[model samples]
Target: MSQNDALHGDDLEKSGEALIEFIKSSNAESVLRGARGKLQEFFDHHIKTKKTTTDILNDLVHAEEGIGQKLVNLEGKKSQMMQEIEEIEQELQRNLSRSQILDSELEFLQKELERLRDAEQEIQTMQQEVDQDTTEVIPSAIYVAQLYCNVTKIKLELDTEPHILRGVYYGGDVAVPINMDTSTRSPCEVSDELWSLVNTEW
Candidate 1:
């Protein structure tokens, strides 16, 4: 109730008039003392058993304050986690970029290795062909040299058997016996077989 509102209304007036009449009809002092006793007892009962609105409201406010503190702590933790997540994402991106560069380099190296392998195979094939050509050409060249030496009447002995040279020059090739031996030339490195074929003792 506001302070401006009247405390007593029409009911209070009638009740007062009746009470005054009763007091005059009976012992007024005794009635007044009994009413005071009843009021005091009622106040004492209310103070002991019932909680006030103010006290309940204060309890609720304390609980709310505790909850608010917990919320603040959680928010701080969440902020730290978010910052850590951002750093991890940045690091992941850098690793992805580095991985991409390594993948490209690996691919290039693989191609270079394949090319080198193919070149090695080609070189082996050329070497085999050169070896085949040398085998077929050597004996024919010796035969030609024998024909030339025989026609010029040059007597060239060799470390090999005489019959072998005779067969190479005369076996269905020339009508007469022939001989030839190639010696090492100056400023040139020659094979051991060629050098040994020259009969130096003869």
Candidate 2:
């Protein structure tokens, strides 16, 4: 009806024709098919990558568990070794104490042995002196007995009685026994050489 309205209707008709032509072209169809192919490729790659990451994470978890178990075993071994070392140290200390005790006992035993040897030597020396005194007394008593027999015209007999030297003077129907004390007080005091000769003759 109006000229302006007629012109607007013609412009709208041209715009709709241009849009229909652009949608029906080969380039638009090719673009749509390429976009669809790219979307499929992206989804496939995402699925593959997710599977790979999950497998890797599972492997890492298993490795960590193995490492933890090894650490626990090592800790147990360390505790065992420490206990053995402590026991060894205690045994060593006990052995050292026993060695010290043994050394002290050995020292005491050596001292006792030395004392016993010294006492034995002292006893031997005293016994030798006593034997020499007894030998001298016997000869002196016999000499006194002989001198008495010569003066009194009796018989003199010399012998050992009860581990001592005895001189028996035999007179007429009488027998008198003379000991060491009687010889020392007798008038005839014989010399050492004469006593030695008497011992040699006997």
Using TM-score as the measure, which candidate wins? 2
What TM-score number comes out for model 1? 0.40
| TM-score per candidate, chains pooled | 0.40, 0.48
What is the per-residue lDDT of model 2 for residues 1-202, given as tens digits with 9 covering 90 to 100? Answer: 8999999999999989988898886488778889988988988889999999999999999999999999999999999999999999999999999999999989977986786576567656655766677655556566555544443444434445443334544443566554444444433543332232231110
Clashes of each: 0, 0
Candidate-wise lDDT, in order: 0.62, 0.67
lDDT by residue for model 1 over 161-185, one digit each (tens)? 6333321222232334443333423
Worst 10 residues of 1 by lDDT: 164-173
Span of 10 residues, lowest total lDDT, candidate 2: 193-202
Which residue runs of candidate 1 sit more than 4 Å off their true CA positions? 1-25, 41-51, 122-202
Give the Å shift of residue 150 in candidate 1. Answer: 46
Q: Kindly state the number of residue pairs that clash in model 2.
A: 0
* Candidate 2 ranges beyond 4 A from true positions: 1-22, 26-28, 122-202
